[model samples]
Target: MGLLDELESEAQRRKSNDEDASVLKAARETAYRTVLEPAMADLLAYLKELAAKLTELQPKIAIRHSLAGYGDVVAYVEHEFDVREVRQPSSKEITVAFHAAVSSSECPSVQIEGGARVRAVSASFQRHRLGAPLAASKDASGEVVAATFKAKGRIPLTAVFSADAASGQLRLSFSNFDDFATAVKTVAPDQVNEELYDKIGRYLMREPTDLMREVLPENYRSQLRARVHHEEVKRRWESQIVSRQQEDIALLKREYGIGARFNRIGDAMGKLRGLVSRK
Candidate 1:
Protein backbone atom coordinates (compact mmCIF):
# COMPACT_ATOMS: atom_id res chain seq x y z
CA MET A 1 0.00 0.00 0.00
CA GLY A 2 3.05 2.31 0.54
CA LEU A 3 4.59 4.22 -2.44
CA LEU A 4 7.95 2.38 -2.11
CA ASP A 5 6.18 -1.02 -2.01
CA GLU A 6 4.15 -0.16 -5.17
CA LEU A 7 7.38 0.96 -6.98
CA GLU A 8 9.13 -2.29 -6.00
CA SER A 9 6.21 -4.38 -7.28
CA GLU A 10 6.15 -2.45 -10.62
CA ALA A 11 9.94 -2.95 -11.07
CA GLN A 12 9.61 -6.70 -10.41
CA ARG A 13 6.78 -6.97 -12.95
CA ARG A 14 8.84 -5.12 -15.59
CA LYS A 15 11.81 -7.45 -14.97
CA SER A 16 9.62 -10.54 -15.44
CA ASN A 17 8.15 -9.24 -18.69
CA ASP A 18 11.63 -8.36 -20.00
CA GLU A 19 12.95 -11.80 -19.06
CA ASP A 20 10.03 -13.53 -20.79
CA ALA A 21 10.55 -11.54 -24.00
CA SER A 22 14.30 -12.19 -23.94
CA VAL A 23 13.84 -15.93 -23.46
CA LEU A 24 11.47 -16.18 -26.42
CA LYS A 25 13.80 -14.14 -28.62
CA ALA A 26 16.76 -16.29 -27.59
CA ALA A 27 14.85 -19.49 -28.34
CA ARG A 28 13.86 -18.21 -31.76
CA GLU A 29 17.44 -17.22 -32.55
CA THR A 30 18.81 -20.54 -31.35
CA ALA A 31 16.39 -22.53 -33.46
CA TYR A 32 17.20 -20.37 -36.48
CA ARG A 33 20.97 -20.58 -36.03
CA THR A 34 21.24 -24.22 -35.12
CA VAL A 35 18.40 -26.11 -36.79
CA LEU A 36 17.28 -23.94 -39.68
CA GLU A 37 20.61 -22.39 -40.84
CA PRO A 38 22.46 -25.64 -41.47
CA ALA A 39 19.45 -27.24 -43.10
CA MET A 40 19.12 -24.26 -45.43
CA ALA A 41 22.83 -24.17 -46.29
CA ASP A 42 22.77 -27.86 -47.24
CA LEU A 43 19.60 -27.33 -49.23
CA LEU A 44 21.19 -24.50 -51.19
CA ALA A 45 24.21 -26.59 -52.07
CA TYR A 46 22.13 -29.65 -53.00
CA LEU A 47 19.84 -27.64 -55.22
CA LYS A 48 22.78 -25.92 -56.88
CA GLU A 49 24.37 -29.25 -57.77
CA LEU A 50 21.06 -30.59 -59.00
CA ALA A 51 20.52 -27.56 -61.18
CA ALA A 52 23.95 -27.95 -62.71
CA LYS A 53 23.46 -31.63 -63.45
CA LEU A 54 20.06 -31.01 -64.94
CA THR A 55 21.56 -28.28 -67.05
CA GLU A 56 24.23 -30.67 -68.33
CA LEU A 57 21.61 -33.29 -69.15
CA GLN A 58 19.35 -30.72 -70.69
CA PRO A 59 20.44 -31.65 -74.21
CA LYS A 60 19.32 -35.25 -73.83
CA ILE A 61 17.01 -34.93 -70.86
CA ALA A 62 15.32 -31.84 -72.31
CA ILE A 63 14.01 -33.10 -75.60
CA ARG A 64 10.65 -32.33 -77.14
CA HIS A 65 8.64 -35.48 -76.47
CA SER A 66 5.79 -36.15 -78.88
CA LEU A 67 3.26 -38.93 -78.44
CA ALA A 68 1.32 -40.26 -81.42
CA GLY A 69 -2.30 -40.10 -80.47
CA TYR A 70 -5.32 -41.24 -82.55
CA GLY A 71 -5.18 -40.67 -86.34
CA ASP A 72 -1.48 -39.75 -86.51
CA VAL A 73 -2.08 -36.74 -84.31
CA VAL A 74 0.85 -36.00 -82.01
CA ALA A 75 0.71 -34.47 -78.56
CA TYR A 76 3.83 -32.88 -77.16
CA VAL A 77 4.66 -33.36 -73.50
CA GLU A 78 6.92 -31.40 -71.14
CA HIS A 79 10.58 -32.34 -70.89
CA GLU A 80 10.46 -34.78 -68.00
CA PHE A 81 13.43 -34.77 -65.59
CA ASP A 82 15.12 -38.01 -64.85
CA VAL A 83 16.31 -38.04 -61.26
CA ARG A 84 19.93 -38.44 -62.34
CA GLU A 85 21.01 -37.97 -58.79
CA VAL A 86 19.50 -37.09 -55.44
CA ARG A 87 21.46 -34.09 -54.17
CA GLN A 88 23.66 -35.65 -51.51
CA PRO A 89 25.62 -32.49 -50.65
CA SER A 90 26.63 -33.63 -47.19
CA SER A 91 26.32 -36.45 -44.66
CA LYS A 92 23.07 -34.80 -43.71
CA GLU A 93 20.50 -36.49 -45.98
CA ILE A 94 17.91 -34.24 -47.57
CA THR A 95 14.63 -35.25 -49.07
CA VAL A 96 14.55 -33.99 -52.65
CA ALA A 97 10.85 -34.61 -53.19
CA PHE A 98 9.50 -33.67 -56.59
CA HIS A 99 6.09 -34.20 -58.19
CA ALA A 100 5.37 -35.66 -61.61
CA ALA A 101 1.88 -35.73 -63.14
CA VAL A 102 0.52 -36.66 -66.54
CA SER A 103 -2.95 -36.03 -67.91
CA SER A 104 -4.26 -37.69 -71.09
CA SER A 105 -7.51 -37.21 -72.97
CA GLU A 106 -9.03 -39.19 -75.84
CA CYS A 107 -9.73 -37.76 -79.26
CA PRO A 108 -12.68 -39.04 -81.23
CA SER A 109 -11.08 -41.00 -84.04
CA VAL A 110 -11.26 -44.07 -86.27
CA GLN A 111 -8.08 -46.08 -86.78
CA ILE A 112 -7.38 -49.32 -88.61
CA GLU A 113 -5.90 -51.90 -86.33
CA GLY A 114 -5.27 -55.51 -87.38
CA GLY A 115 -7.16 -54.66 -90.61
CA ALA A 116 -10.28 -53.84 -88.58
CA ARG A 117 -11.77 -50.34 -88.36
CA VAL A 118 -11.63 -49.60 -84.61
CA ARG A 119 -13.00 -46.64 -82.71
CA ALA A 120 -10.61 -45.88 -79.89
CA VAL A 121 -9.77 -43.41 -77.14
CA SER A 122 -6.82 -43.12 -74.78
CA ALA A 123 -6.86 -46.09 -72.41
CA SER A 124 -6.08 -43.62 -69.62
CA PHE A 125 -8.99 -41.33 -70.48
CA GLN A 126 -11.10 -40.18 -67.55
CA ARG A 127 -13.91 -42.66 -66.79
CA HIS A 128 -16.71 -40.12 -66.59
CA ARG A 129 -16.10 -39.20 -70.21
CA LEU A 130 -18.06 -42.32 -71.18
CA GLY A 131 -20.93 -42.19 -68.70
CA ALA A 132 -23.54 -44.97 -68.45
CA PRO A 133 -23.89 -45.78 -72.18
CA LEU A 134 -27.63 -45.19 -72.22
CA ALA A 135 -28.65 -45.37 -68.58
CA ALA A 136 -30.58 -42.39 -67.13
CA SER A 137 -29.01 -41.00 -63.99
CA LYS A 138 -28.03 -37.71 -62.32
CA ASP A 139 -24.54 -38.10 -63.81
CA ALA A 140 -26.05 -38.50 -67.28
CA SER A 141 -28.09 -35.29 -66.87
CA GLY A 142 -25.00 -33.14 -66.18
CA GLU A 143 -22.25 -32.62 -68.73
CA VAL A 144 -19.95 -35.61 -68.30
CA VAL A 145 -16.73 -34.60 -66.48
CA ALA A 146 -13.62 -36.62 -67.14
CA ALA A 147 -10.89 -36.98 -64.54
CA THR A 148 -7.20 -37.36 -65.40
CA PHE A 149 -5.10 -40.40 -64.61
CA LYS A 150 -2.78 -38.74 -62.12
CA ALA A 151 -0.13 -40.55 -60.06
CA LYS A 152 2.21 -38.85 -57.60
CA GLY A 153 4.48 -39.82 -54.72
CA ARG A 154 6.55 -37.56 -52.47
CA ILE A 155 9.39 -40.04 -52.66
CA PRO A 156 12.07 -41.12 -55.18
CA LEU A 157 13.79 -37.74 -54.94
CA THR A 158 12.73 -37.15 -51.34
CA ALA A 159 15.22 -37.72 -48.54
CA VAL A 160 15.54 -37.02 -44.82
CA PHE A 161 18.66 -36.63 -42.67
CA SER A 162 17.25 -37.68 -39.32
CA ALA A 163 15.95 -41.00 -38.04
CA ASP A 164 12.50 -39.43 -37.91
CA ALA A 165 11.33 -36.48 -39.99
CA ALA A 166 7.80 -35.29 -40.68
CA SER A 167 7.36 -36.25 -44.34
CA GLY A 168 5.83 -38.74 -46.75
CA GLN A 169 9.15 -40.55 -47.17
CA LEU A 170 7.65 -43.69 -45.70
CA ARG A 171 5.39 -44.00 -48.75
CA LEU A 172 8.37 -43.58 -51.10
CA SER A 173 11.58 -45.49 -51.58
CA PHE A 174 14.32 -42.95 -50.80
CA SER A 175 16.92 -44.99 -52.67
CA ASN A 176 14.84 -45.38 -55.82
CA PHE A 177 16.14 -42.35 -57.67
CA ASP A 178 15.61 -43.57 -61.23
CA ASP A 179 12.24 -45.22 -60.73
CA PHE A 180 10.09 -42.26 -61.72
CA ALA A 181 8.06 -44.14 -64.31
CA THR A 182 7.29 -47.03 -61.96
CA ALA A 183 6.35 -44.58 -59.23
CA VAL A 184 3.93 -42.83 -61.56
CA LYS A 185 2.30 -46.11 -62.67
CA THR A 186 1.93 -47.16 -59.05
CA VAL A 187 0.11 -43.94 -58.12
CA ALA A 188 -1.77 -43.43 -61.38
CA PRO A 189 -5.53 -43.93 -61.59
CA ASP A 190 -6.62 -47.41 -62.65
CA GLN A 191 -7.47 -47.37 -66.32
CA VAL A 192 -10.60 -49.04 -67.64
CA ASN A 193 -9.92 -52.66 -68.58
CA GLU A 194 -9.73 -53.83 -72.21
CA GLU A 195 -12.94 -55.84 -71.97
CA LEU A 196 -14.83 -52.76 -70.83
CA TYR A 197 -13.23 -50.69 -73.60
CA ASP A 198 -14.32 -53.19 -76.23
CA LYS A 199 -17.86 -53.12 -74.87
CA ILE A 200 -17.97 -49.31 -74.94
CA GLY A 201 -16.70 -48.90 -78.53
CA ARG A 202 -19.90 -47.06 -79.42
CA TYR A 203 -19.59 -44.75 -76.42
CA LEU A 204 -15.92 -43.89 -77.01
CA MET A 205 -16.39 -42.89 -80.63
CA ARG A 206 -16.94 -39.22 -81.48
CA GLU A 207 -19.51 -40.47 -83.97
CA PRO A 208 -20.97 -43.79 -82.90
CA THR A 209 -20.61 -46.54 -85.47
CA ASP A 210 -23.85 -47.85 -86.93
CA LEU A 211 -22.86 -51.48 -86.17
CA MET A 212 -22.54 -50.58 -82.44
CA ARG A 213 -25.55 -50.04 -80.20
CA GLU A 214 -26.05 -47.28 -77.59
CA VAL A 215 -27.07 -49.85 -74.98
CA LEU A 216 -23.85 -50.87 -73.21
CA PRO A 217 -23.31 -54.48 -72.30
CA GLU A 218 -24.71 -55.59 -68.93
CA ASN A 219 -22.44 -54.31 -66.13
CA TYR A 220 -20.00 -52.62 -68.56
CA ARG A 221 -21.46 -49.11 -68.06
CA SER A 222 -21.45 -49.52 -64.30
CA GLN A 223 -17.92 -50.86 -64.42
CA LEU A 224 -16.75 -47.89 -66.45
CA ARG A 225 -18.52 -45.45 -64.14
CA ALA A 226 -16.96 -47.07 -61.10
CA ARG A 227 -13.50 -46.73 -62.61
CA VAL A 228 -14.18 -43.06 -63.30
CA HIS A 229 -15.17 -42.43 -59.72
CA HIS A 230 -12.14 -44.30 -58.41
CA GLU A 231 -9.83 -42.21 -60.58
CA GLU A 232 -11.60 -39.01 -59.49
CA VAL A 233 -10.70 -39.77 -55.89
CA LYS A 234 -7.05 -40.24 -56.83
CA ARG A 235 -6.97 -36.95 -58.73
CA ARG A 236 -8.33 -35.08 -55.74
CA TRP A 237 -5.80 -36.63 -53.39
CA GLU A 238 -2.89 -36.13 -55.85
CA SER A 239 -3.65 -32.41 -56.26
CA GLN A 240 -3.77 -31.90 -52.51
CA ILE A 241 -0.44 -33.66 -52.13
CA VAL A 242 1.15 -31.46 -54.77
CA SER A 243 -0.25 -28.32 -53.16
CA ARG A 244 1.08 -29.33 -49.77
CA GLN A 245 4.48 -30.15 -51.20
CA GLN A 246 4.82 -26.63 -52.58
CA GLU A 247 3.36 -25.06 -49.47
CA ASP A 248 5.76 -26.82 -47.08
CA ILE A 249 8.79 -26.08 -49.22
CA ALA A 250 7.84 -22.42 -49.54
CA LEU A 251 7.16 -22.02 -45.82
CA LEU A 252 10.56 -23.47 -44.84
CA LYS A 253 12.48 -21.32 -47.32
CA ARG A 254 10.67 -18.16 -46.17
CA GLU A 255 11.41 -18.80 -42.50
CA TYR A 256 15.06 -19.48 -43.27
CA GLY A 257 15.49 -16.14 -45.08
CA ILE A 258 14.17 -14.01 -42.20
CA GLY A 259 17.10 -12.65 -40.06
CA ALA A 260 19.50 -14.81 -42.10
CA ARG A 261 22.36 -13.32 -40.02
CA PHE A 262 24.34 -10.22 -38.96
CA ASN A 263 27.88 -10.66 -37.57
CA ARG A 264 27.51 -8.93 -34.14
CA ILE A 265 24.18 -10.69 -33.49
CA GLY A 266 26.01 -13.88 -32.48
CA ASP A 267 28.30 -12.05 -29.98
CA ALA A 268 25.32 -10.08 -28.69
CA MET A 269 23.39 -13.32 -28.09
CA GLY A 270 26.36 -14.82 -26.21
CA LYS A 271 26.38 -11.85 -23.79
CA LEU A 272 22.60 -11.95 -23.40
CA ARG A 273 22.64 -15.65 -22.57
CA GLY A 274 25.44 -15.07 -20.01
CA LEU A 275 23.40 -12.33 -18.28
CA VAL A 276 20.18 -14.36 -18.32
CA SER A 277 21.87 -17.38 -16.76
CA ARG A 278 23.57 -15.23 -14.10
CA LYS A 279 20.14 -13.78 -13.13
Candidate 2:
Protein backbone atom coordinates (compact mmCIF):
# COMPACT_ATOMS: atom_id res chain seq x y z
CA MET A 1 0.00 0.00 0.00
CA GLY A 2 1.04 3.64 -0.52
CA LEU A 3 2.31 5.64 2.50
CA LEU A 4 -0.91 7.74 2.44
CA ASP A 5 -3.10 4.61 2.40
CA GLU A 6 -1.17 3.08 5.31
CA LEU A 7 -1.52 6.29 7.34
CA GLU A 8 -5.28 6.44 6.64
CA SER A 9 -5.74 2.83 7.85
CA GLU A 10 -3.82 3.54 11.07
CA ALA A 11 -5.91 6.66 11.72
CA GLN A 12 -9.14 4.69 11.22
CA ARG A 13 -8.04 2.02 13.69
CA ARG A 14 -7.13 4.66 16.31
CA LYS A 15 -10.49 6.47 15.86
CA SER A 16 -12.42 3.25 16.59
CA ASN A 17 -10.33 2.60 19.74
CA ASP A 18 -10.67 6.22 20.84
CA GLU A 19 -14.49 6.09 21.05
CA ASP A 20 -14.41 2.97 23.27
CA ALA A 21 -11.66 4.42 25.45
CA SER A 22 -13.62 7.63 26.02
CA VAL A 23 -16.74 5.70 26.99
CA LEU A 24 -14.81 3.51 29.42
CA LYS A 25 -13.19 6.56 31.05
CA ALA A 26 -16.55 8.33 31.50
CA ALA A 27 -18.14 5.21 33.03
CA ARG A 28 -15.26 4.74 35.45
CA GLU A 29 -15.42 8.34 36.67
CA THR A 30 -19.20 8.10 37.14
CA ALA A 31 -18.83 4.94 39.19
CA TYR A 32 -16.11 6.54 41.31
CA ARG A 33 -18.22 9.60 42.23
CA THR A 34 -21.52 7.72 42.76
CA VAL A 35 -20.12 4.83 44.80
CA LEU A 36 -16.41 4.90 45.74
CA GLU A 37 -16.04 8.58 46.72
CA PRO A 38 -18.92 8.72 49.20
CA ALA A 39 -17.67 5.61 51.00
CA MET A 40 -14.12 7.00 51.17
CA ALA A 41 -15.35 10.36 52.44
CA ASP A 42 -17.23 8.79 55.30
CA LEU A 43 -14.21 6.76 56.35
CA LEU A 44 -11.92 9.80 56.04
CA ALA A 45 -14.18 12.11 58.06
CA TYR A 46 -14.42 9.57 60.87
CA LEU A 47 -10.66 9.16 60.92
CA LYS A 48 -10.11 12.92 60.93
CA GLU A 49 -12.36 13.45 63.97
CA LEU A 50 -10.76 10.54 65.82
CA ALA A 51 -7.22 11.75 65.17
CA ALA A 52 -8.04 15.34 66.01
CA LYS A 53 -9.51 14.34 69.37
CA LEU A 54 -6.54 12.15 70.22
CA THR A 55 -3.97 14.81 69.33
CA GLU A 56 -5.87 17.53 71.19
CA LEU A 57 -4.38 16.29 74.47
CA GLN A 58 -0.88 17.44 73.59
CA PRO A 59 0.50 20.00 71.14
CA LYS A 60 2.11 17.35 68.90
CA ILE A 61 0.93 14.24 67.09
CA ALA A 62 2.30 11.90 64.43
CA ILE A 63 0.28 10.88 61.39
CA ARG A 64 1.48 8.29 58.88
CA HIS A 65 0.11 8.47 55.34
CA SER A 66 -1.10 5.37 53.49
CA LEU A 67 -3.12 4.74 50.34
CA ALA A 68 -4.49 1.43 49.14
CA GLY A 69 -1.37 -0.63 50.09
CA TYR A 70 1.26 2.08 49.66
CA GLY A 71 2.82 4.26 52.33
CA ASP A 72 3.55 7.79 51.08
CA VAL A 73 4.51 10.27 53.81
CA VAL A 74 5.10 10.61 57.56
CA ALA A 75 4.20 13.72 59.65
CA TYR A 76 5.33 14.71 63.14
CA VAL A 77 4.33 17.47 65.56
CA GLU A 78 6.23 19.26 68.36
CA HIS A 79 4.01 20.61 71.15
CA GLU A 80 4.64 23.28 73.75
CA PHE A 81 2.78 23.69 77.06
CA ASP A 82 2.89 26.38 79.73
CA VAL A 83 4.62 25.10 82.91
CA ARG A 84 3.90 26.59 86.35
CA GLU A 85 6.36 26.14 89.25
CA VAL A 86 5.53 26.96 92.89
CA ARG A 87 8.45 27.16 95.35
CA GLN A 88 7.51 27.24 99.04
CA PRO A 89 9.59 29.16 101.69
CA SER A 90 10.02 25.92 103.75
CA SER A 91 12.47 24.43 101.17
CA LYS A 92 9.55 22.66 99.50
CA GLU A 93 8.94 23.15 95.77
CA ILE A 94 5.72 22.23 93.95
CA THR A 95 5.25 21.98 90.18
CA VAL A 96 1.82 21.96 88.55
CA ALA A 97 1.28 20.69 84.99
CA PHE A 98 -1.67 21.48 82.73
CA HIS A 99 -2.59 20.79 79.09
CA ALA A 100 -5.68 20.76 76.87
CA ALA A 101 -7.69 17.60 76.17
CA VAL A 102 -10.71 16.99 73.95
CA SER A 103 -12.27 14.19 75.99
CA SER A 104 -11.75 12.02 79.05
CA SER A 105 -9.74 9.55 76.96
CA GLU A 106 -7.36 12.33 75.90
CA CYS A 107 -6.64 13.55 79.48
CA PRO A 108 -2.98 13.27 80.56
CA SER A 109 -3.46 10.79 83.43
CA VAL A 110 0.16 9.90 84.31
CA GLN A 111 2.29 11.40 87.06
CA ILE A 112 5.43 13.38 86.23
CA GLU A 113 8.43 11.11 86.83
CA GLY A 114 12.24 11.42 86.60
CA GLY A 115 14.75 13.58 88.59
CA ALA A 116 12.52 16.69 88.26
CA ARG A 117 12.23 17.80 91.94
CA VAL A 118 8.84 18.39 93.59
CA ARG A 119 8.63 19.14 97.33
CA ALA A 120 5.83 19.15 99.86
CA VAL A 121 2.95 20.91 98.20
CA SER A 122 -0.43 21.66 99.85
CA ALA A 123 -2.32 20.65 96.68
CA SER A 124 -1.95 20.18 92.92
CA PHE A 125 -4.47 19.91 90.09
CA GLN A 126 -4.34 19.09 86.37
CA ARG A 127 -6.53 21.46 84.39
CA HIS A 128 -7.41 20.78 80.75
CA ARG A 129 -8.27 23.81 78.62
CA LEU A 130 -9.41 24.32 75.06
CA GLY A 131 -6.74 25.16 72.47
CA ALA A 132 -6.89 28.61 70.89
CA PRO A 133 -5.39 30.20 67.81
CA LEU A 134 -1.85 31.53 68.06
CA ALA A 135 -0.82 34.91 66.73
CA ALA A 136 1.16 34.81 63.49
CA SER A 137 4.91 34.76 64.07
CA LYS A 138 8.09 33.65 62.35
CA ASP A 139 10.37 30.92 63.59
CA ALA A 140 14.14 31.34 63.96
CA SER A 141 14.60 29.80 60.50
CA GLY A 142 12.33 32.56 59.01
CA GLU A 143 9.50 30.12 58.28
CA VAL A 144 5.97 30.96 59.45
CA VAL A 145 5.79 29.72 63.03
CA ALA A 146 2.81 27.56 63.90
CA ALA A 147 1.56 26.76 67.36
CA THR A 148 3.31 23.98 69.31
CA PHE A 149 3.28 22.51 72.82
CA LYS A 150 5.44 20.23 74.99
CA ALA A 151 4.12 17.14 76.66
CA LYS A 152 5.35 13.82 78.07
CA GLY A 153 5.14 10.55 76.07
CA ARG A 154 4.91 10.06 72.33
CA ILE A 155 1.38 9.90 70.92
CA PRO A 156 0.66 9.02 67.30
CA LEU A 157 -2.55 9.91 65.51
CA THR A 158 -3.74 9.13 61.97
CA ALA A 159 -5.81 11.40 59.72
CA VAL A 160 -6.63 11.40 56.00
CA PHE A 161 -7.05 14.68 54.10
CA SER A 162 -6.79 15.41 50.38
CA ALA A 163 -5.86 18.38 48.21
CA ASP A 164 -7.49 20.22 45.28
CA ALA A 165 -8.07 18.62 41.86
CA ALA A 166 -4.96 20.17 40.29
CA SER A 167 -2.78 19.56 43.36
CA GLY A 168 -3.68 15.85 43.73
CA GLN A 169 -3.50 13.90 47.00
CA LEU A 170 -2.35 16.12 49.87
CA ARG A 171 -0.79 14.26 52.78
CA LEU A 172 -0.56 16.85 55.53
CA SER A 173 2.81 16.50 57.27
CA PHE A 174 2.34 18.52 60.47
CA SER A 175 5.73 19.46 61.93
CA ASN A 176 4.15 21.61 64.62
CA PHE A 177 2.31 19.27 66.97
CA ASP A 178 0.92 22.17 68.97
CA ASP A 179 -0.63 23.69 65.88
CA PHE A 180 -2.30 20.41 65.00
CA ALA A 181 -3.64 20.09 68.54
CA THR A 182 -4.95 23.63 68.42
CA ALA A 183 -6.54 23.00 65.05
CA VAL A 184 -8.30 19.92 66.38
CA LYS A 185 -9.65 21.78 69.39
CA THR A 186 -10.53 25.02 67.64
CA VAL A 187 -12.23 23.37 64.65
CA ALA A 188 -15.80 22.77 65.86
CA PRO A 189 -17.42 19.41 65.16
CA ASP A 190 -20.19 20.96 63.09
CA GLN A 191 -17.98 23.61 61.55
CA VAL A 192 -15.70 21.43 59.47
CA ASN A 193 -15.17 22.92 55.99
CA GLU A 194 -17.17 20.95 53.44
CA GLU A 195 -14.97 22.03 50.53
CA LEU A 196 -11.88 20.78 52.29
CA TYR A 197 -13.63 17.52 53.06
CA ASP A 198 -14.70 17.05 49.44
CA LYS A 199 -11.21 17.79 48.10
CA ILE A 200 -9.66 15.34 50.52
CA GLY A 201 -12.36 12.76 49.77
CA ARG A 202 -11.76 13.00 46.03
CA TYR A 203 -8.03 12.55 46.54
CA LEU A 204 -8.45 9.48 48.73
CA MET A 205 -10.83 7.87 46.23
CA ARG A 206 -8.55 8.51 43.23
CA GLU A 207 -7.18 5.37 41.54
CA PRO A 208 -3.76 5.64 39.91
CA THR A 209 -4.62 3.52 36.86
CA ASP A 210 -7.82 5.40 36.27
CA LEU A 211 -5.99 8.71 36.68
CA MET A 212 -3.30 7.65 34.18
CA ARG A 213 -5.87 6.70 31.52
CA GLU A 214 -7.81 9.88 32.17
CA VAL A 215 -4.81 12.18 31.75
CA LEU A 216 -3.47 10.49 28.57
CA PRO A 217 -5.48 11.39 25.45
CA GLU A 218 -6.35 8.93 22.68
CA ASN A 219 -4.01 10.77 20.23
CA TYR A 220 -1.14 10.43 22.73
CA ARG A 221 -1.73 6.71 23.05
CA SER A 222 -1.76 6.35 19.26
CA GLN A 223 1.49 8.27 19.01
CA LEU A 224 3.07 5.99 21.66
CA ARG A 225 2.06 2.88 19.69
CA ALA A 226 3.55 4.34 16.50
CA ARG A 227 6.80 5.18 18.37
CA VAL A 228 7.04 1.60 19.65
CA HIS A 229 6.62 0.21 16.12
CA HIS A 230 9.29 2.57 14.81
CA GLU A 231 11.75 1.39 17.50
CA GLU A 232 11.11 -2.30 16.66
CA VAL A 233 11.64 -1.62 12.97
CA LYS A 234 14.95 0.11 13.73
CA ARG A 235 16.13 -2.85 15.84
CA ARG A 236 15.26 -5.38 13.07
CA TRP A 237 17.05 -3.24 10.44
CA GLU A 238 20.27 -3.33 12.55
CA SER A 239 20.04 -7.17 12.86
CA GLN A 240 20.08 -7.55 8.99
CA ILE A 241 23.35 -5.55 8.63
CA VAL A 242 25.66 -8.61 8.75
CA SER A 243 23.79 -10.38 5.92
CA ARG A 244 23.67 -7.16 3.91
CA GLN A 245 27.48 -6.89 4.34
CA GLN A 246 27.91 -10.44 2.95
CA GLU A 247 25.68 -9.60 0.00
CA ASP A 248 27.76 -6.46 -0.68
CA ILE A 249 31.00 -8.60 -0.60
CA ALA A 250 29.63 -11.03 -3.22
CA LEU A 251 28.51 -8.14 -5.46
CA LEU A 252 31.94 -6.42 -5.15
CA LYS A 253 33.82 -9.68 -6.02
CA ARG A 254 31.55 -10.45 -9.01
CA GLU A 255 31.22 -6.92 -10.41
CA TYR A 256 34.24 -4.91 -9.25
CA GLY A 257 37.89 -6.19 -8.89
CA ILE A 258 37.68 -5.98 -5.04
CA GLY A 259 37.98 -9.18 -2.90
CA ALA A 260 34.67 -10.55 -1.41
CA ARG A 261 36.14 -10.58 2.13
CA PHE A 262 37.37 -6.97 1.80
CA ASN A 263 33.93 -5.89 0.54
CA ARG A 264 32.25 -7.23 3.73
CA ILE A 265 34.83 -5.46 5.93
CA GLY A 266 34.44 -2.22 3.97
CA ASP A 267 30.62 -2.33 4.20
CA ALA A 268 30.76 -2.97 7.99
CA MET A 269 33.26 -0.07 8.39
CA GLY A 270 31.02 2.19 6.32
CA LYS A 271 27.99 1.38 8.54
CA LEU A 272 30.06 2.17 11.66
CA ARG A 273 31.26 5.42 10.13
CA GLY A 274 27.70 6.45 9.29
CA LEU A 275 26.60 5.72 12.90
CA VAL A 276 29.53 7.75 14.33
CA SER A 277 28.93 10.66 11.96
CA ARG A 278 25.18 10.72 12.77
CA LYS A 279 26.01 10.94 16.50
lDDT of each: 0.38, 0.39
The TM-score that candidate 1 achieves is: 0.23
For candidate 1, the clash count comes to 2
lDDT of 2 by residue, 136-252 (tens): 245577653332222223333223222222211222322212233322111212223454445433322221222111345799999999999999999899879977999999887
Cα lDDT tens digits, model 1, 105-200, are 322233323211111223312221221112212235463233222211122233232211222111222222222222311110122133322322
Candidate 1 lDDT: 0.38
Q: lDDT score of model 2?
A: 0.39
- Compared with the true structure, model 2 gives a TM-score of 0.25
Badly placed stretches (over 4 Å) of model 2 are 56-160, 163-279
